[model samples]
Target: MTAIDIRDVSLEYGEGSGARLILSDISLTVRSGEFLSVIGPSGCGKTTLLRLIAGLVTPTRGAILCGDRKVDRPSRDRAIVFQDYGRALLPWRKIWSNVALPLEGGNIQGAALRERAIELLKVMRLEAVADHYPDQLSGGMQQRVQIARSLAQEPKIWLMDEPFGALDAITRQQLQDEVARLAAERNMTVVFITHDLEEAIYLGDRVVVLGAHPGRVVEEISVDLPKPRDQLTTREDPRFLAHRHHLFGLLQGH
Candidate 1:
């Protein structure tokens, strides 16, 4: 039940004369146990906002709170899954060990660590590749491995930065469904950044659209669709189409 509150957040690069604002007074709420989809143009500061929430970086003019705690730096309670699977995973380490990396910090070793890693890997459908290295798996599989690693951390919040953008259409859609299911089942608070409108609608409980040029929230739409969203039926639903048309128009204007 961890909710994220971003208050009048703003980020700037450089300083004084050279300072360029990347985000300006961007404020929004991610409800507890809700899947929030953030979509915008190429330079909308979507990733920057995600990084701020992850505490990988700090806001120059505002505060971000996870529940009641301020986010000035990274915490174990938050886990980030980046789009670059090649860099995110260690090719040297086997899949099981990669998934086990976070748990090792807590001195959770031997059978305990193995069991936990396998449980998460199984959840991500990567149990069969436990003995393989990152190089041995496909791009989609590697992403799943990264997700398993994130799950091992047992974070209160899941922050993803266009994680499925690198995969093919079929693979991306498959992983999209997997992610949606995982978020709902575990009740993990998620903030997903993506450029895909359909992907955003399909996965998010609500979608927040950001306008470019010193990125700011322009629109927030609640997806009134039912749960257990099916790929075929959900996309074909009239409501989904309507949301798509309206969001498309909004993005075009931004």
Candidate 2:
């Protein structure tokens, strides 16, 4: 069940000698309901790849297919969660209202929208702050709200770009587990981007390492750990350490 097929993709900015190539000959298939984490050094075009799948940008060459359809523009089927939750949410709207924003455009209205928002808020453990504004919440709570809002879209694929990079270590781990749980319970397909090797290995079913200088897949390793990953046990597992070592070496050009 391939959810996304990116075929021989290449992205270039500008034209002629001034052209800057970002991604070269990139190809990969993302299975439905699979959790894929992408890690790379700075300027690897990791976020660009995500934006490409989100239909926010087009590859200068090759095509990207979502299911049987070719991706040309952004659709509700794909939802993106950015690192900057403050900018992502509308401060004017309440936490619940922000979560329900997507549903308002559709046929759902009134109590139905509120009910849906509350449901997702509870999933994110954000029920306590349902009526509060984004400004009133902590960074972690704000990020949770953003996650809840993304869920409100009920997207087939979730594209998260360094979603917890700015949070404290403790909060990051908590949200990592939360996201893993939600994705599993909802049977979601997620494309998570991060610079943290341990974070990637901890949450991903498969970790895709991208190389810089025209980003392309360097290595893709499957995580053999058990589901409902334990932060303590999973990270301390020999297999987890092995993956961390391998990916670290790959990134370091060892």
Off by over 4 Å in 2: none
In model 2, how large is the Cα lDDT of residue 126?
Answer: 90
TM-score attained by model 2: 0.98
Q: What TM-score does each of the candidates earn?
A: 0.97, 0.98
Q: Write the per-residue lDDT of candidate 2 for residues 45-130, one digit (tens) a residue.
A: 99999999999999999999999999999999999999899999999999999999988879888898898899989988898889
Write down the lDDT that model 2 would get: 0.95
Pairs of residues at least 3 apart in sequence or in different chains that clash in candidate 1: none
Clashes of 1: 0
lDDT of 1: 0.93
* Cα lDDT computed for each candidate against the true fold: 0.93, 0.95
lDDT of 1 by residue, 1-254 (tens): 44999999999999999999999998888988999999999999999999999999899999999999999999988999999998999889999999999999687778898888999999998999999999999999999999989988888899999999999999999999999898888889999999999999999899999998889999999999998899999999999999999999999993
In candidate 2, what residue range of length 10 has the lowest lDDT sum?
A: 101-110
